[model samples]
Target: MNEADALVDGEPQFWGGCEIALNTEPLEVIKEILKACGGRLFEIGGVYKLYVGAPGLPVLTMDDGVLRADEAETAKPIRPLDERVNYISGSYTRPEDGWITRVGPPRFDASRISADGRVGADLDVPVVQSGKHFQRLQQQLLNNAAKERRHNLPLPPSAWGVEPGDVLQWTSEHNGYEDKLFEVEHVTDDHSLDSVAAVLEIDHDDYDFDPETDLIEEPDGVLDVDRPAPKEVGSFAVAGVANVGTNNTVRPAVSVSWDDPDDADVTAIRVAYRIAGQVDEPGYAFSYEPAAGQLLIVNLQPATNYEVKAQFESFNGWATETTPWLPVVTPDIRFSQNDFNAAVNARMAQLDTASQAAIATVRDALVNDLTNLAHYLLGQIAKLDDQDQAYQATQGAAVNVVSEEVVTEKQARAAAIQSVEAALDDAAASLIGQIAEVDDKHNALATLFGQVFAENGEGAASALFRLIAHAAPTGVAARIALEAKTAAGAYGEDSAALFLDVIAGVGSVATIKATAFRVQTATGFAPILEVQDDTVKIAGNIGVQGDALVDGSVTASKIAANAVTAEKIAAGAVQAGNIAAGAITANKIQAGTITADRIVTNGITQSDADSGSASGAANGTWRTLCTINIEKDSGTRGVMFLGIISGSLGGSTSQSAADIEGRILRGTSSALFQTSVVATIATGGAFTIPMSVGFRPGSVPNGNHTIRLQVRASIPGGVTIAASGYLYSMLPRA
Candidate 1:
């Protein structure tokens, strides 16, 4: 305890710099006051640590012990910026905001800091830090954070989906095949899409598509009407997709059948399609009924192919043209609505269970018309009350000495409550005139069985088995064998029962002609590709590899690059991504492009600095980036996300417009990446932008960046406006 006589009895006798109080408490009296004082603790955040200790006092608060001053530089002391010693201090068990208040010695408020002599020029660095500089910075940050969560996991097998967004191209022979589009903001429970699983926002340069694993995928370019078609029909059938259907009048019905020496009467049936070598557009060829010397037909796009020759009418009249045969797409059968709803709801819940059983057989024939409409509106409101002695002892009782069957059971319970309020006003006026035919029969059976199997056409999966047997009056092959699945691709693990976040993995091949590519690199879930085995499947979620995920249910704390990881979700939760919908806030969060690996949520209120990484995103203080749940002027806004987030939070590299949410809530794209980090954008607050864009087609892509608004100020400023159709500026850039 005589550490230099406790630093000369804790020095006080004022004046000429002679004091000593290095009681950092121990570690050999703070290594004899850091071998007598120079400096260390470079930087940290959230709590406290400014000890350049021994530089004769800057400020000390050890939870309030005392000694301070640096009032910006109180009388030329000039010292507090060697990495400012790290102190953001908002506290979550202290991340660094410690050493409360201190400015830098009014000559040490009458002196003290020195216990083992020397206290000032003690520099030789190395007071403690080395188990290999923190075990190689925690194994290079957990292997670059599992390679940055498999490099932003949007899943095109974790290589990232092809940049910007929106893609629906098609063509095979005359070139063109396209179909299966979906994305109206990542489905909001497509009838509980049978326990969700599909997320695709991808684009880390689309991993150069090398994919493989087989589904049929072979074809590739050329077929100006059978120039060399036939891609994978031999090795014995079962692997399909030719493309085109609905209204270009049909050609995608291929299955021509040859070897006919006696199957009689049919001539001229040979063909081969799927062209457009690496694309240049125009892949044309027509003829649904016009023929003569050679009607090779055209217009084949969206993944391609063409092969033709149809001129055999015969009844002994004179027709014979046979020479074009070569269409693909054979892979059929797909069933897997969670393994066919666990084998048709385990055989329809062992022959029955979500039990409403038609609301218990129409509530036992409307239980005496709902107990005679509640005794005819409680006896017509107990005949305008007033006699209320419990309706005067069963009221108006004078039926044959006490019972003509209780006066005909109160007139058949007041005529069965006026015939159950006239059968609930005639079944709500026949379901409000079939509410636009039940939204056109669930949008015409989920869009005519999704356009008969979304084009890999053979009359598009027999036109979706003839429009689900002309729109299910009964069962239509148990919901298309529970949304069929055989060629193998779609899957889910439990992203809160999934709509996205298997946390992320996307695969699609859909071919008309030009093929080859099933997904290569970043492989995790057992690499498998080749596709085209009658493609047309796409179903539910699809984040494509904007950066691999499949980990939802949030809980992650700090891991940045783009964002989102802390998953679990459910308190106003509605993520989406790729395009946008980011709003997870108790303090703050705004997602759209955090890429994905684990952002899920389930009621997380914990704020130990939200739990870690992404650089404490500034302790998320009031974290509002793009808020728009559903009512800006009124309020409840959940799962919302407007748009138009132009850009800028004051890094001022210039390029400023910033909007983010004029009105989004239409389902949100993973909370629109937290409106990207709205540096200072305020136009009407609660995040606003989206001016209604319509341009998606092959033009505005390549990550479509934005940032130039350099105004600098100094007398070069002006502001102009016209409003209406458009014309706004802040002039003075001469």
Candidate 2:
């Protein structure tokens, strides 16, 4: 136990380092110091020592007495164990040849050995070529065989020193255990200062009696040398399984999650999947990194159930325990097909709804248009009827006038008839033009209707509507125009006939005059036929009708001078040739009866005179005495303005006499007449001066001409002119 005894009794070791000092008493620091000295502090054979240069090998014999499994000291009853199977069958691929080599027998189940003489479980490991891989397969198969029949040996408090990884030899004559090897796998330490004892749990191990190689036989009694020690087999678990999605063809996605373990030796995670009932067939196997525990399996059959398992691989390419199988199912393809059909039907329904809405809108607008057009046509027809009535009234008036008047009184009536005819012609032409305009409008409306409805699909309905809408106005305008024309023609004919009757009546009057002349010339009597009594007159109506009179039949040579009188002449029958120059003198003619139209050559004269006196007392300033506007006819020959100014100069003396001046101006021209008179009068005396001014504004345009009389006087006192002024203009013939 001392340092010098530990060095003499224990083995000597060499540690290359310099001597150093430490000032800590902690157990960790003591252990670190010893470890730095190339040694470890350990207890062996009830003695503690710092030993180096590797530990002693474990002894694997029953007579050594360091560890033993005695049945009498056991705390639990022993059970009979099943024998483990030997011989493994698997296939491996040689990387150089790319060929699979199968080793061992196919069928080797020990459970069936009693029935069919099969001795071991024929386990299969596929695609294993490397020596390390083969060794892993062999160890896994042996572990499986050992696990089938495991023995749990419990040790009492007396064996409290026994620890895990320690090998023990069991010796018991009654339970048929002689020289069987077991390793302590677990131990329960209950031996505190007050506790009674501890318990040791052990599992069977294949071991050997050799002093150098500590090998063991398998459970089925096959002594295999160089067997690997039992290792703690740990596996990553499949924590979660999920179905991500599926395609239209029913291909599914599956993802799995597992623990990473965080072991540097762990390289990857392995996944295997198959249909639920088809485990015998070859399934899918995939490998992924250990950090990524998820896997996705695709292209699975539709509506099919599946199972999956996951495991992890070590850096040595050895697989650990696999997770329990998980169940999944691929989606059905019919669901997707139903969804697609629903979408298509929904879209079609939307389009149909939109189309029906559009059709309804168009139909409503078309109906409104038709209603408006119908109303318009009715209005036009009403207007045409009014025009027709007006035309009829005009025609009736023209016709009545023609039928009521007599031809003997038609001399004055003839001119009235001509005027009426002219008016009727103008009215008829206007009515006709209006009717034509209506016809054009109707045609335009029809064309518009055709164009508007032609674009619609309802052709028959549109055509019927067009015809119905236009028929009334078209007929009404045409009928009115026809009636107006007929009335106009009748009125014209009646008027012409009436005019001829008047002409004939004038001829009859001439004949009557000629007969009188002939009677007077033949009998040499003043009266052709004298009446003796007042009642000696014809009772029947007298009528004189003829078309013409002979040229010399009614001459003066055939009649008495006073026989032909005013009463015998027709109103419009007398011409210039029928009267002598002096026959109708001015005194004999009626006053104002000869208008300007009857006097063709003599132009008109307008004259005005004023007699009021006007005076201006201021010197050297003109005063307008009077103003007159003379209307000169077009082609007026001359204008004359005359004034007789009479006034007295109040302050006229010999030294300073008063001078008065007068002037006449036309329009804006210079003085047409200017005169000045100087007189000397001590006491105011009257002076009279006559002024005459005339202008021949040659060929004066038709307008009113103005004349003004103005006078100015010298200083001290001014002269005044009595308003005896006259302005006149005479228009001569052009």
Candidate 3:
């Protein structure tokens, strides 16, 4: 990457990592990375550059000479400002909990809504942690969304100097544009048209964001919702038509049937019903368990009209809206014979009146047609008679021929009248037969009514009503729909099909009690969740949040390998006795979990401790005594350089001293611990000087290091140093 690209690429500013799944498209991964940093990748002059936050400073100014004067007057917008994206929403990983939580754009008074209202786009920065960096990301995204106005500016060849991601200043009087700054999204050259146009969008900068002042609200969560309500009151209908209940006393009733609310929180349903127009009267109410298919509302007045509606109750509160009121009219207790007869008679009379009216209309229309035909025949006869008289005056023999023609025409008119009479007679016969058929049906209905309204209470109608309305006999219980069962099963209640069985509890709160709950997987059955009288066992993976308040000790064998992470254990919660011997190896101990003070002396193994002996003699110049190379793992630790130097101390002059030093070298840095042995005379048999050095390199880079003992004499007399050194490396707590 180029130096400039790397600077704006957010590598140093926002430190994070993302897990890339296999088979993920390279372009998608690149896009997500760029989005996480509020950056954009664009190609300029054959080279690709990734701009992290915003475009660079303005490169040039476009005025009359650089821009096409006439084209600028009709400059077209790349997209209407109102149609550009504004609101942003998406998911990001929360560092504290490692949960992928949804986040919305930061609130800013200057932010604008698109034409369609709250037009939004998702900016998923799943790798971002919940902190100031995440807020800054949101701020940058909002600022980018605010820069929605982009216009296509026609420019001269001189404007070609502006490249993509370059901000440019433009002054125009045509569209009332002042000395406004715009970033060049891209520039297009048309050789054929001899024109160059650049797409310029409003530019954003550091001035648009103020980390200290702007709001950095928490991410969207479940509790952030103001008040959630059910999406729907599912499957509502009124049942039990034409039914009467006589459990304690006879009364008309209807069953309110409905499914559970779509919302899982809704626990029960409340129904209210009263006479349709009795608003001032007290209404009856009934509460049904959640998902109860049906409930009978009894004690209603016979033949009375009522309206009922249902409302749902959730943990949050009651639903804001209720189901629309449904109207129902109770059936009368009895029907008298006189009343039934009168109803049938009234209906029959209506049919008779309609039939008579239709017949009269047809009779009038036929009479008028016959009258018009007679008038036309009369006029024709008079004209023919006049022609016959004129013919007699012209020729006496023709007068007898006219008389014979008139006689033959009169005979044909009589035959036509006979045919019409026969057709009218058939229509009358058909009407009479229909009337007789209707009378026969009416007589049959009267006979049935007699049987139904028989004097005694043991009529076929009463038997039929009881047979249909009363509950079925014991063995045929399956024929009727099963009643809904409750969490506490009640006696005399019918069986029900349950989606989930809650063994105990009242109302909405419930507990699932089971000796063993076996889950079936593709492999086989597994008792993933089991409940005992005082203990619970889970054979599969389980997640626990917050502090685990264990009353009893958790055995080592019960805990799975790697189940308890460094973060999961509280500081100082684990003691030496709590850990089994050899249970924790060097590899198992996290770098910062254990400190020097926390580790017991015996915690250091033989492999980590080393000792060596060296004998050397030197005069004036420093001489190497003993050297040991120790390999250090990448962890926070400290090492001690310890040794004992004993040898003859001799110098050219009396009171001269021999100096011994212990040095620890790692990379380019070293620490030294020095001690001296003084001789009263020029020579001495031997002396011992103990040198110990403690180097607490808090967190040094990992590699092999050398610790050595060196000796030197003050004067030119042989100085001998025999040294035994030891090196111990220890890890410290985080």
Candidate 4:
């Protein structure tokens, strides 16, 4: 057991080793059906640790898989992964016949990085590759890697003579240091230190600096260390295989299914899958909530055996139990481009869809809590008010102010007993965490929310509220004091949740997010509202804030509060119920459908006075209420009408036969619409389309909306009915 015995290990265990003649059966014939991608078929009953070679490249059975080693035993015409596909990826070595040639030396990256604490990136990514082929191949691979930025190693760290990023390394006994296994830091003077080294990275942090931090350590000393040879849990087979490709690296994979018998207390299931037959790769760790009982395997090399194991971790008991599962046999796959793209795209989309809805939902939840908070504040104040009055009358009316002060001074302490009578900010955060524990996904978000930008916002709001809360007078001032606390709490809960929701929602997670943002003016900048209560202003117009939705009739960037009309509407159909609900308001009233006992049409003008137009009447320049705006001038501008259509601003512009447009029609009311033509088409800074149509008070005949126009002038080339049309609703009975 000296030098000769030291050269070998594992008791010369051979499971699938033999020299079978090449042909078409259990020899070369059987291999044709047995060889798998990134692997060769080993003899079914004879071998383990066999030596072999595919043309141009040796398809080494460094471990096991190849059934035989005889050249005659190699299969005939089996499809293999293209070697080109493995070039930069180092996925597979390809045979001369376009089959994936077997690859050895997974530790090749070790050579460039272990010389002198320096990773030699300057070392060319070596290959037997030709210049022309490599150039085209490298570019494509680069693009692929670029698209997968998540997988890209961090850009090398920037520093003087060193870096703190991913560097290739290997463990090997160097320079007869008594078999001290040192991490390869760099290749010194182009010398290969050993024929059997495995890659590893340096991970030591030396803190004590003897001379103000410049104690020079030799290169070999920095990495020098002894480690026993790594043990190999030799090749095994996986059972019940499923999906792969969760990662970009090529590896063996198999499906696994198991359950925690004690389901009520479990929190998560952790799985580790790793490729075998290599000395360099590390296994991956993936954890899933107990909720995802099943997981799909991915990133596997076809026909390779991947070792997989799952551990169930329980939240209730804080214990983890492991389960042993079978190995998988990766099958040879030749996928069509379209099929591949389609499958991967669907997988990626699945990752994005759920998150898209989550943001809006969490936002709505915050808003709901805020609203509830207001309701709670009202309840607490009423209770406090009643208490104050009861004590005042019962004790002495003379002590009203003093007694009130005493009550409030004691309120926070007293309220702390009942349901935390803190300010709004505190109340809101309490609710978010309170709600999170109700759902698993919600709780996970809460955990992530805490770890990421800590709800410092809530903390900040609480801080601000406490400042205001503590500053108030003790007695009568307490009521006002508490409100500030409540408001602060509300802001904290709202702002923090909103911030996190926003980041998580972006980046393909959320499809749509709507928020009402108030504009804050920069210091020294003053904005004035020219139109009082204006909802929309010109794009460049200076104002307090812009609209969250689309611009209305104006191109203005901001809108002044309460300026827009209640009569104005967007895409939705205006309903009769809305009139009673207080949403409907107009300067004049014209009853449409009389669904009630009677109808009241106050100041209803004759149909001839109305002018109703559609989108194209003025060639899309029309903005409803554009003319009602006094500041600007438009070609379609005219006198403002309410109860009914009105004639033009000019008396001479009216034509009795001009088409009259119908008013918006309500349910059960079809509207017959028509429009009056432009009295005259004017030049620069002006133009016009004077149109109108009307119906019986509540009976809009078409129930469909139309621009009923009366041509009073040249009526330039009559308009044609469009492919798509518009519809509307009549006014509710008044």
Q: Which one wins on lDDT?
A: 3
- Please report, in order, the local distance difference test score of every candidate based on alpha carbons: 0.25, 0.42, 0.51, 0.31
Q: Rank order by TM-score, top first? A: 3, 2, 4, 1
Put down candidate 3 lDDT per residue, 532-584, tens digits, no spaces.
Answer: 67767777556452247474556779779878875444345567776679978
TM-score of each: 0.13, 0.18, 0.27, 0.15
Q: Model 4: per-residue lDDT, tens digit, 483-548?
A: 112333453333322221122223212221112223322222333212224353332333232244
lDDT of 1: 0.25
Two-way TM-score contest, 1 vs 2, winner: 2
Task: Put down candidate 1 lDDT per residue, 1-734, tens digits, no spaces.
Answer: 12212221133111111123565455544443332222223222233233321112111111111111211111111222331111111101111213222121111101213322222211221221211211222222222112110111112122222221222121212112122221111211223222111212222221111223111122222223322222221221112344343332233233333233231333333343444233333233332222222333333333334333223433343434434434444333233244444454444442233123322322343343334433444554465443433454665544236566655655654454444455444432221100101222233232111111121211112111111212344322212211222223231211111011111123322222223224332324332444455563332233344245555533345334544333322222343554234444435654453444443332311101000011111112221223221111111111211122222122222323332112212233332222232222222111112222111112222221221111111111222111111101110110
Worst 10 residues of 1 by lDDT: 607-616
Q: Which residue pairs overlap in candidate 2's backbone?
A: 108-120, 109-120, 206-216, 207-215, 207-216, 208-215
Report how far residue 304 has shifted in candidate 3, in Å. 99
Candidate that beats the other on lDDT, 1 or 4, i.e. the better one: 4
TM-score of 4: 0.15
Q: Candidate 2's residue-wise lDDT over 479-592, tens digit each?
A: 101111122234223221111111221331111111112222221345344334343433223323222565555566866766545445334345677676878877976566
The segments of candidate 3 whose C-alpha lies over 4 angstroms from its true place after superposition are: 1-15, 69-82, 99-116, 190-195, 205-207, 219-734
